[model samples]
Target: MISFSQVTKRYPGAGGGYEALKSATLDIQPGEMVFITGHSGAGKSTLLKLMAAIERPTSGTVLVNHQNVSTLRASALPFVRRNFGLMFQDHKLLYDRSVYQNVVLPLNIIGYNAAEAGKRVRAALDKVGLLAKEKAMPVTLSGGEQQRLAIARAIVHRPSILLADEPTANLDAAYALELGELLRSFNQVGVTVVIATHDEQLQSRLQPRCIALAQGRVTQ
Candidate 1:
C-alpha cells in the first residue's frame, strides 16, 4: 500500500540546506505491521511524517495505494490523509473536550453525521477499552487512558492505514505493552500498521518487520 522510491527530504537552512532523509526507499504492503526504529535525529520521525503527508520530500517519490503522494495537490491532500490514521508522541488530546468529542472531531471533519459518528466513536473507544470514559474530560483520565483516547480518535474514521510515532513514550511498561497489543489487533483486522518508536522492549516483543535508521539512512 506504500512505496517510497528513493525519497529524500531536506530542510532549507540559512546557508544552504540540511538533508533529513537521504534517498531512502521502502515498500509496505496492505495488512502488514511494520516498526521503524532509530535513535534521536536518525530520521525515523521524518520517514513517518513523509508517509503521512505532514511533510513533502525534497526528491524522489512516495506512493500510497497507487497514487504518487509527492505530486498530490493541496486540495486533494485531505482526501489522501483521510485514508490513514496517525498517532503522535504526545497524546494531543484536547484537555477541555470530553473523550467522545475528541474522537468525534475527525468524523465531524469528514462530514459524518451525529448518529454515525456516535456509533463509530463508541466502537473505537471500546476497541481501546475506553468506552466507559467517553464522557470524561481528557485531563481527568490517566496517561494510558488518554493515549487510548488518541488511538480511538485516530481509528474512529476507519482509515485503512495507521501510523503511530513514539506512542509509548510517556506510558509505563505495562501500558506500553497494552498499547502494542491494541495496535496489533487493529493490524490483524486489516489496518496496515506502521509504528515509529525508540522503545526496544516493544521491538523485541512484537517482532514486526523492523526498519532501522541512522543519520537519515536506512541501516537495517
Candidate 2:
C-alpha cells in the first residue's frame, strides 16, 4: 500500500520553482488497480516517481508499505525500489539486445543466477504474449509488440507494484485495448497496478479507480 500526504514536488528554476504536485494526498491499497489521469504536465509521472522513490517530495510525506520514502537515505532507495516495476512512457528498451536479454537485465542487476533468470524471463514474456519473440530484436517488433516487451521487462522481477507511465500512448485503439486487458490481468492476480495516462478511452474501458489531476492539483 502507498500513501501521499500533502505531497508537493518542486523543481528549482530561475523564476522561483515549478511545482509538479501541490498538496496531493491519495492512497493506493495493496493489489488495487488505479489510474492517474491528467493532461500533460499534470504531475501524473511525478506521483509515480514519488511512489517508486525516484523522486522525494519537496514537502509532506510519501509512505510505501509503511516506510517513509520521503526521508529514506540514498543507500536505501534501491532496496525500496526493488518492490516496484516501472514502465516508462518511452519503451526504454536496449535496441541491440534480444527481447529475452532485455527482460533478463533486471534479474542480472539483482544477481539472480542464470537458471532462475532464464525461467523468469520466459514466464514474463509468455505473460505478455511475447514468448515467441524472445530471440527477436526490439526494432523488429511492431509497436504493440514493443509495448508488450516493455511490460515483460517490467514484470520479470515479479515486483509487488507496477508503475506504468503512459502505457497506452501512441498505439492504435485495438492495441491499446489489448494492453489495457493485459495490465488488468496482472491486477487480477494481485500485483498493484498504477498507470499514469491521458488515454481516456482506455481508462473508460478498464474503469479502474481514477485519480484525476489538473494544474498539478488532485482535482478529484
> Global lDDT for candidate 1?
0.91
Worst 10 residues of 2 by lDDT: 70-79
lDDT of each residue in 15-36, candidate 2, tens digit only: 9899999999999999999999
lDDT of each: 0.91, 0.93
The reply for model 1, stretches above 4 Å from the true place, is: none
Worst 10 residues of 1 by lDDT: 88-97
Candidate 2 to truth, TM: 0.97
TM-score, prediction 1? 0.97
**Model 1: per-residue Cα lDDT over 83-187, one tens digit each:** 889898887788888899999999999999899989999999998999998899998998888899999999999999999989999999999999899998999
TM-score of each: 0.97, 0.97
Error of 1 at 180 (Å): 1.1
